[model samples]
Each structure stands twice: as structure tokens, then as C-alpha cells.
Target: MPGRRARRRPVGDALAGTGRFTCGVPEAVGVKRPSLDAVRGFDRAVYVVAVGQLINVFGSGLVYPFATVHFHLQVGIALAVVGLGLGARSVTTAAGTAVGGYLADSVGRKPVMVSSMALSAVALASFAFVPALAAAVPPGVAAAAGVSRVGVAFVGVCVASGFVAGLYTPASSAMTADLTDAEARDRGYALLKFTNNVGFGAGFVAGGVLYSLASVSVFLLDGATSAVVAVVLLLYVPRSDVGGDEEADADVDSSAESGASLARWWAAATQPRVLALAAINLGIAVMYAQMQTTVPIVAKEGLGLTAAQLGTLYVLNPLTIVLLQIPLVDAVAVWRRTRGLALSAAFWAVSMVVAWAADVGVGPVAVGVALVGGHLVFRTVGEILHSPLASSLMSSLGTDAERGTQLSVLEMAKRVGIGLGSFFGGLFFDYGLSTAWWGVLVVVCLGVAAALLLFERSVTPRENGAFGDATES
Candidate 1:
């Protein structure tokens, strides 16, 4: 046989054409099988980042969620004041995301990432150290300041941490894009999302135990992990070239690439389909916010369920992702991106209806089971479909040079979603929890789904770019 074909092809294409094996045997054995390596191969940075994310997310789970609780319970701050502090944190995050994305493109992904993580550790340390400092103040000074000093310091640190996280994410996300080619982007993101959820679920569960032991320990542990992750990125992950390097352009077929210009950024910002997708994502996020707001209150107060039960309901979403993400990614790998997103939005809508019914209480046992089991199953499916697919879409739509800026726009939309979701969810809850969940949220999901499907149809074949559309025909 000839050693070479008439034309060159990618290794994956060559392997697919060969069909030399069936589950480790020759295909003449009466079965044909595809090589798994084609799907499994990825840049080393992907795995390293995945591990770093696991550490950072787990450490975050151990403390971040409980920060508000700590302020309210341990520090004697009012719930309203704690809410204001958190709200301010969200605003700072949005600002940081804008700055980070610009810097990731202008400078380099690694520098921004390492600096952000290091700063995050410092912020967490501030949280850990302030209480101790407050305790040591002279009695006269301590009496004069009371808990106000500690509260002020804690809120300031929380805001700083949020900003640092904003800086870390776009760089990290852009770094993922830098490492993997278009072929591996979906699987790479799926793996990243899976690691994040696993770490988060475990962290939230373990955080309870840590909180019981000592609240201060939570912040200290979170800070330590952030520091470790920063070191790992600095030492292990190979230095990323600045976004416009010659090699990076080769990866994207940079025919469409142009020199750095504000016009390119403006073009990406004004792309109709991209903006539509971002808006749809924002709506979905607003619907999701109810889980943090109206859902838990109704589950506990309306249904007479314990805090443990509500916590279980919350855990199921991440648990499902951790267990099923890879399998689900493989399952939908052939589907068109738009169809998957439409199906996901449908699932989100359905889950909201289930939550609404559960809130009204069809039956104690049945409602509890539906709220825990049904909602988790449906909502997790939406999450599995949406998260990786959206990341891949963003990767596809962007030019190599403008990728960070494009992603920053998407992140900004998410922040808007969170702010709007929290504000509206709170206001509507005053009218009635049922009105809040079913009337406001369920409707938003349906509208977003419809709009997403419309955009799906409008996605021209040419728009598929180097990362071809995977949406079902």
C-alpha cells in the first residue's frame, strides 16, 4: 500500500477513512467502530486548567456562598445590608469583566489570569484577617467602632473578590480558546463546565461542615486554594502568545482577520445574531435567578420543608452535571447548535412550570419529589445543553483577535441578567411567590426560547466559520 494519499488530510479525517479497527479489532470481524482518540485528544493546557478550576471552585464553594450567611449570622449584620453588599459586588464584577477582556487581548491571557488569581487570594485573606484585627483593637476603640469596622472591611473584601473573579474568568475562558482548536472546543468546554460543577457541588456541601467548625476557616481555605491555583497556572501552563500571534492566526484561517481596530470591536458588538443570542441568554439567566430567590422560600415556607430538603434540591443541578456532562456532550455532539439551545430553553420553561406546581403543593410527597427530582432533571438537562454549546458558539462567531472582546460582551449580558433577575425576582415575590415564578419567569423562558429558535434559523451556513455549526438539521 502507498504510504501517502494523493491529498493531505487532518489526522482525524485520515483515521476515519482508514476504519482499520472495531473496538480494538480489525473491521473484518463484522463490526465497525470509530476511534475514540479523535474526540479525546486536546491540548495539555485544557487538563491543567480543568484541575485549577476544580481547586478554585471547590475552595470557593467552601466559603463564598456562606459569606452572606456569615455576615448575617456571625457578624450581626442585617440581611438587607448583606444584600446591598452582594449587589454591589455584582456591579464591580461587571466592570472587572470589561477591563479583563480588553487586557487579555491587549496584553496576554497568562498575565491577567495570574494577577487576577493572586489578587483574589489577597481579597479572601482580607476577609479572613479583618475579624481578627477587629478583635484585637483597644477596648475603647473597639467599643466605639463596634461591629461596623469588621462589616465595612468584609464588604470591601467581598467587592474586591468579585472584581478579581471578573478579571480571572474572561482570561481563563480566552485561554481555553487559545489552547484548543475549533474541533476540540466543544468537548474542552464541556469538560471545563463539568469540573466547575463538580467542584462547586462538593464545595457547597462541605462548606456546611466548615461553617459549623469556624466561619473564618472558610475564607482562609478559599484564599489558600486561589493562591495554589495561581501558582499552578504560572508554573505549569505554557505561556500563551498574545492574541494576534502568527501561529494563532494559522489556527483560525485568518483570511477574515484584520489589524487591531476599534471598528472590528464595534462590528462584533453590533452583530445582530450575536446580540440576539446574548439577549436570549440574559433572559434565561433571569429565569434561573428564581432558584436563588423565590424557589427556596416557597419550598421552605409554603411546603413546610426543612432547610436540608431545600439544600438537596439545590445540589441536584450540579450533581446531575458532574455525573452526566460528558455523556450528554457526546449524545448531542451531532445536533445543530440552535436546536440544542431551543430544546434547552424549552426545558427551562418546563422546569419553571414544575417548580410553580410544586410551590402550590399538589401533594406533600409528590410535590417534594417533583421539586427535588423533576426540577433537577429538567433544569440540569438545560444546563448541560446550554453551557458548552453557548461557549462553542461564542468561539465560533468570534474572529481570532476579537474573541476576548466578544466573550466580554457575553459576560456583560450575564451580569445584567443577574442584576435584573435579582431585582425583579425580589419585587415580584412581594406580590406572591406563585406570581413571581409562573407569571414572570415561565413567560420569560418561553419568549427567550422562541427568539432563540428564530435566530437559529437565521444562522447562515457561511456564518458557521471555522467551527462548523453542530445544530441538528
Candidate 2:
């Protein structure tokens, strides 16, 4: 009654006596709740794409986790060869990203995404069928194909998959940017990340199960999911020009250089503020790379953990993210994005130290577990702080006309971080576990924090406004 308006009626009237309470009319409600408003305001394409992502990622999950293992064991490729194949994939992926970004800007986002999905599906299918085909060849034909043919074909397919992925990444990212405004981009991308991880976790488990059951089934299912995603996009995503024209912004940026070179793909990406943020991102990514290369080796060899025990630790990272990502993003919605990023970097930095200290005693396994769990919690906390805000920040930095090109550059920076991080992490580990886990990682984290501070200072007030101006709701 306090919050609602009531109509007066005669107390003795039968109608009044029989009436059940109806509090407020729709028109009388002055504003919608934030949750409802958020749902109502979302671009239909975002939801559609989210669904497609879930399907596609789950499929990818089945094969990606087992790729190296499959090549080495089932395909009988040497471990070193498999490693070489992976490196080749990364190289193609980087090149593809650059080209994809340019195309997303030149043509459109949806076409590039849909086409890439379809192409990737074909590549995945080849991954499944090529081995069987190679085996079935006549003796003479098989001789012509050579003993290494199966391995070569699989690697080629992997390379193609990488290139296709590159073609799609910029378009997909730019599409999300096109659909969201600066204000809503964080939540939009947050939801996307949440959806993606859910799929990723599911895929990780399911892929393992399928791999054990039948190795090739993983690739078949992965390819099927890709096809399904392509179909879904074709049916549901709108075809309108989503990446808005920002010719004026492009003109402004171009004029500052006095002249534009035909070969200067980096022109839009070289803004001082953009470069600084990209550097900080690269640093954080280097720290992140440790989870894959450094953490597992240390856990097994240094901590005396079993393979199963180590797997459990790996699971904790995404599980924590899937459960807490949204709440964490919402919690920090009131803080400046830059400040939030710095806080996350600190958490990540401290987590490495905690993990290092946990190994001092070789005490109770439970104690080790507790310490590692604490590290995971903090790492995920940092992830929550970084993931959504980072996407939104990158999106906000780009103009409409150059969004795809600029974002591709950002993606390349990330790839560079991963490549270099893995390289340095292995080098450090070779020297000493402490050197890699403590010295290198800690220094990188500090650099990330410092870089972020510099970025905050160098950028205009508007750039830091994501949290300051974000409505509480």
C-alpha cells in the first residue's frame, strides 16, 4: 500500500467487498527494474549469437583438449611434430585475424562469421575422416601418400582450422561491439563470457568422455556443432549492417597523421592510449599463460600430485569463472574500469606467491589443496575483474569505421602474449621453478599494474567513465 496507489470505493458495495487487491497498473510503475530493463534492451542478435557460441564452443571442447594427445598417440605423429603443428596453427591464426579484421570492416561481420563457421566445420570433418581415408587407400596409393601422410593431412586441417578461426574472431567480436553501446558493453560481453565458459566446461568433460569412448567421435561431433551454429546464425541473426559507419571518426584519426599510407594497417591501432592498454593486456595474458604451461608441471613434479589431482585443479579455474563471473562484474560496476583492472592484477600477482609458498612443506595433501584452492579463487577473481571490462574497453576505444581493424590488432597483441609467455615460462622453468613461478610472474604482474596506472593517467576522463557513469542498476 505504501508504494502503490489505490482507488476509492464505497465500503458497502458488493463489488468492493468481493475485490481482490491489484496494486499498481503498468503505467503507474515509473521505471522498470534493472534486470527486466537489461533483458528488454538487449539486441536480439546478442542472444542468438550467445546460443550459437554455446553450441560451437561445446563442440570445440570435444577436440581441442585432446588435439595434441590424439596426434601423438592415435595418429602416431611424434610429439615434437605435434608441437610444430600447433605452432603453425598459431601462426596462421594470427595472420587470419589480421585479414579477418580488415574484411569485417570492408564487407560485414555476419557474413565473415557465418562463412568461417561453415569452413571450420569442413576442416573439423576432415580431421575426423582423413585418417580413415588414408588407411583405406590401396597399397600403391598408400605408398604414394607416404607413411607420414596421415600426420601431414591432420596438421594441414589444423592449420586450416586456425585460419578459419582467425577469419571469424574479429567479425564476432566486432558484432558484439556493434550491438552494444559503451554503457552496456561490459554486461553484454560479461554475459557472452559466462555463456562461453559454460559451454567450454561442458565440452571439456564431454570431450574427454567421448575421446575415451572413440577418438574420432570428438571431431565428428565438433564438426556437427559447427554446422549447427552456422545454421542457427543463418536463421536467427539479422543481416542488416550492424557495424555503423564512423567515417567522420576515421577522418579525424587519419588527418592527425597528415597523410595515410596504403600499408599502414597499424595506423588506427597506434594511438598512445590504445598502445598502452594493449601492452598491459599483453602482460596480463603472459601471466595467464602460466596456468597452461607452468602450473601443471609444477603441480605434478614439484608438488608430487597425481595426474588426476592436477586435472581437478585445472577444472577449478573455469568452474569458478562460470559460477562467479556475472556477480563479480556487477559488483565492480561502480568502480572505474581501470581501477578494477589494477585490483585484479594485484590479486593475480599475489596468487602466484601463495601457490609458491604452498609447496614449502610437502605437508598434508589437504593443506596443499587448500593453498592451491586459494590461488584459484584469487585467479578467478582477477579474471572476473579483467575479462568483461577488457572487452568493453577495447570496443570503446575503436571508432565505428575502424572497429574491426583495431580489435584485430588487439587480438594479435593477445596472441603475441600467449606465444611469448609460453616461451618465457618454459625458459624460466628450465632455469628453476621459483624463477619462473615467483620471479618472472611477479614481475610481469607488477608491470601490468603499472601499465594500467599509466594508461589511466594518459587517457581522457571519458575513457575511464565506464564505472563512474554506470548506473547502479
Candidate 3:
């Protein structure tokens, strides 16, 4: 009996012992059972973080959509000045993300998250007081201040808030990766994005009503929500969920050993695949940036639509995401991620073409509405395909020690792309080339799609479709 290699345990029995799969009588009899944990797509810690993010993003939605309006109308600042302030905020946010990633690796994830949220709350609360404070100053002193006090205060708050956002991004992303294993990470990220859109959509509607009834109240409410999220995270989440160097001697040793942290950071930055993915992400981000900046402007001016009509049409984006994102995740569970990304870009390209048609006035009002609706639906599909896959891919690129830095680098690329997109978008519009802008974006998207295919070939076989059930190895 001993020489018989001991009758091999059934696959179901072995897997059940690992606690990764469910075992039933049928499974014990050699049938395979699906994993319940994989189906749920989250552990307890990740769920807590997702809830906090939902609350935080809801607060952001309550204020961000109205930031430019607040600066231009209530504070009596010029549009150019408001634009400059927003640009500055974007730049600072980019820098903040880079710095935040380094800190997330050196310090712990929880500290960075908690501190960022707390600081963001302070900065947001300060917004409500800026107009009042600016008005309180004497007219002569206000003139002596060069730019208006309101502008200065507003820009300062924007800079501060952007920096805090940068800090939070890498920390939160790395924490999510820490809490989720590779198999479930795709669904985890998709669920997070889903919650974000849900929160933003609900807050957007409520913020509109609140802004009309009492504009100042929106800022206060946003700040209060940030405070609540910070508190919830501090009280509920455990530090051990994301490992940290607890001993003072270990920290000193890490620092004393010829800057080991810096060496690791440099290694992460130089990873060929990481850089390639970041570049692709930058291109995607540029395309996505149009939605927030150029799309609305083009929809209104180029297509001759009213503000209300544009808002109504834009609602389709979030609606599609909420209804279809999870189902799409399940539907595409077997897809190679590279193929999914390429397909996403193709969708964006088509959407851009549709947008171009609407901009050029190629049809009547009813036809134009249909074209724009189709454009939104296609763009939303691209986003659904891209976001979760990109996040999961980046998270897979490095160890826990290096994951924060890698994700940060990816985020920085996105921020830079958004800045470039906004700049180029405005430049094109100003130069009376708005119609051509969509065509250019279409080209960019197609190029990205092609590049991703080449990228897929360049990576190792195991890395090509690691997220799906059919890994080559």
C-alpha cells in the first residue's frame, strides 16, 4: 500500500483544504465546484475601503462640478483666472501623486490615506469662507493685494485639495491590491469604479438642487462628508491589512543601509512593462479627458445644444455604467486583458467619429440627438473595459513594497495626459479648429489600440492574459 503512491487525493479535496474553493458531494466525487470567494470579488477590508471611497467621491461630486462656476460667478473672478487656477491645481496634483507614491512605500498605506482625507476636509471647508473673507477686507487693501483676495484664496484651496488627492490615490490603490488576490482583483476594481460612479451620479443630482437653494451649503456638506470618511477609515480599517515596518530599528536600518528604499523606488520606475503600460494609460487618459472638458463645450457650441439638453444627454454615461459594469465584468471574465484594452480603444475611436458627425451638423435635431447618444454609449463602454483592467494590470506589475510606486507612476501619467488634453482641446477650440479635434482624437485612439497589440506581444506569455482563467503557463 505504501509503494502504491498512496491513492492521490481528488482535486476537489485538495482545493477545499486550501480554502479557495467550495466542496460538495458532487465535487468530492470528482466534479469541480466554482469558488464563492471569487464570485463575491472582495474580502472584508476591501469592502470597507470601497464604502469609504464611495462616501469620499460623493462629497467630491457635490463640489467639483461647480468649482469653476463658484470662482467665476460668486467670487467675481474672470474666467481666464479661474482656468489658470484649475491648471495650477492639476499640475500640483500630479506632483502630489508622485510624492504620495513614494510616501506610501516608505510609510504605511493607512497613515497616508487618513492624513490625506483629513487635510482635504480642511481645504474644502476653507472654500466656504474664502468669499466672505475676501469681501471683509477694505477696498483699498483689496486693490493693494494685486489679484483679488477671493482668487488667491480659491487657488490656494485648489492647490491644497489637489495635493491631498494625489496623496490618497496611490495609498488607496495599493491598499486595494493588498486586500485582494490576483484572481479576484479585476472584479474588485470594477466594483470600486461602479461604487464611485453611483456615488457621483447621486451626489451630482443632489448638489444641483442644493446649489440652487443655497450654494454655500454644498461646500460645507462636502467637507463634512470628507470628515466622516476619514473617521470611518480610522476606526474601522486595521493597519495590519497593509503591512508596515513597525519597529523603529527596522526603519533606521532601512534608511542606514545605503538608501535601500530609493534603490527599490528606482527599480520600480525603470521596469520596462510598467513604463509601457503607463505610456498607454497616458494616451487613454488624454482621450478620456475630453469628456470632462471639451465634450461639453463642443456639445453646446458646435452642436447648438442648450445647457439643460447637454446635461440630460450626459446622464447616459453614468446610467450605462451603473446598469452594465458588473454584468460586463462577468461577461468578459474570460477575455485576454490586452485584447480587452484594444477593444476599448476601438470603442473610443468610434465614439469620436460619432462626435465629429454631431459637431459638423450632419443631420437634423433628432438625428443629432441619436448620434450624440450613441457616442456616449460607446464611450461609456470603452471606460468600462479600460478602468478595471488598467488598474488590475498595474497592480500586478510589482510586489507590495513597489506596488504603490508603480500605481503612482501610472496615475501621474494620467494626470499629465489630462492636463495636455485640456490644453490642446482649448487651443483647438480657440483656433477655430474644433471640428478637427474629434478627428485627431480618433487617430490617437486607433494608434493606442495598435500599440497595445504590439505591447501584448512584447510581454511574457504568463503576463499576457494573467487576469483570465486561461493563463498560458
* Clash counts for all predictions: 7, 0, 0
**lDDT of all predictions, in order shown?**
0.67, 0.67, 0.72
Better of 2 and 3 by TM-score: 3
Candidates ranked, most accurate by TM-score first: 3, 1, 2
Name the 10 consecutive residues with the lowest summed lDDT in model 1.
464-473
Worst 10 residues of 2 by lDDT: 24-33
Model 1 lDDT, full chain set: 0.67
Ranking by lDDT: 3, 1, 2
User: What is residue 39's positional error in candidate 1, in angstroms?
Assistant: 6.3
Q: Name the best candidate (by lDDT).
A: 3
Cα RMSD to the true fold for all candidates: 7.4, 10.3, 6.9
The residue ranges of model 1 lying beyond 4 angstroms of the native Cα positions read 1-39, 63-84, 125-158, 244-267, 296-313, 430-434, 462-473
The deviation in Å at residue 295 for candidate 2 is: 3.6
Model 1: what TM-score? 0.78
Q: What TM-score, over all chains together, does every model reach?
A: 0.78, 0.75, 0.82
